[model samples]
Target: MNSGVFITFEGPDGAGKTTILSMVANHFKEAMVTREPGGIDIAEQIRKVILNKENTAMDPRTEALLYAAARRQHLIEKVKPALEEGKMVLCDRFVDSSLAYQGYARDLGIDEVWSINQFAIEMLMPQLTIYFDIEPELGLKRINKNKEREINRLDLENLEFHQKVRDGYYLLMERFPDRIARIDASGTVEEVYEQTVKMIKDKLAK
Candidate 1:
């Protein structure tokens, strides 16, 4: 039995997940908000390499490994400690991002990527995961409109690849229906945030 609750927010780029997560974090005074690959010093260094646009030659498997490595370090340095202290840990992304982006979208085989991540996380899974569902085209449009947000390496991926990432999220949702909740992210930010809060509150009520 885990001592603290782990909740993850997952979505394709431009899905407004980060925006909503920030709002939700503020609402939950006891919650600790963090993101993958850069939540801690070691992980932040790994994140820089992974998101470097110049590293186009990086292999799909290599990208997956780097993400897992960063994830492991973040979990050790930040997430687990917060959880141990009985704080509600709200992470922006977790293993699902790897499964969707690298495993399915990159043609790395979901099962194969999952096996490696299993080793990284040591069976530590989120108690709840909220997936923001949106069309890939619309998501990209949102990203393009948001000039303030940094355009990362993943943002440069083509539309077809992003579509596959969305599909991968859906597949994972089917696999973990009890843990993953879908929220339509096409609406206004306030609308989406309300839905997110409701989900989190409902989960906590249980």
Candidate 2:
């Protein structure tokens, strides 16, 4: 059996999950820090296609499939090997993203998207998922103000779509309460970072 701890960070766009995750990674220097859809070379290529702003014609189901495909390669090339070596793995996103973005937000059934990911991951689920919660308006506001952040295809989605994504995450939290820890993300960066660090420390202690 694998011995390492697998933790995933998740949130709506501009919920600051990526920034907070980077800080958390610094605290846990020994952990393997990575991101979904772009951890390894093959996955990164797929990520480019999925996130490319020019890919507006991409179908919802196709988007979901591409995410699953990237996830599979990332697991094989990075996550599984690190876990086998007993290293703590902290990932920016994972299957939960596809479930929220493609499944619920895209109007596709969550169960349907989940079934596709099941085949790719084969039950490799994160031991802990830190979900940063924020209002869709605030999240989008932050994204628009951040010049350094890349404007992906998803970022261009309407406010209603983003709200749906947040709602999807809420549903997921209810579905997996035991595994997901929710944190208010509207606070300052330092505040969110502190909460995230504490959450990870608490989990590691367990």
Which 10-residue span in candidate 2 carries the lowest summed lDDT?
197-206
lDDT per residue (tens digit) for residues 111-172 in model 1: 99999999999999999999999999999999999989988899999999999999999999
lDDT of 2 at 17: 95
Clash count in backbone of candidate 1: 0
How does each model score on lDDT?
Answer: 0.95, 0.95
Best lDDT goes to which candidate? Answer: 1
Clashes of 2: 0
Candidate 2 ranges beyond 4 A from true positions: none
Candidate 2, residues 11-85: lDDT per residue as tens digits? 999999999988888899999999988999999999999999999999999999999999999998899999999
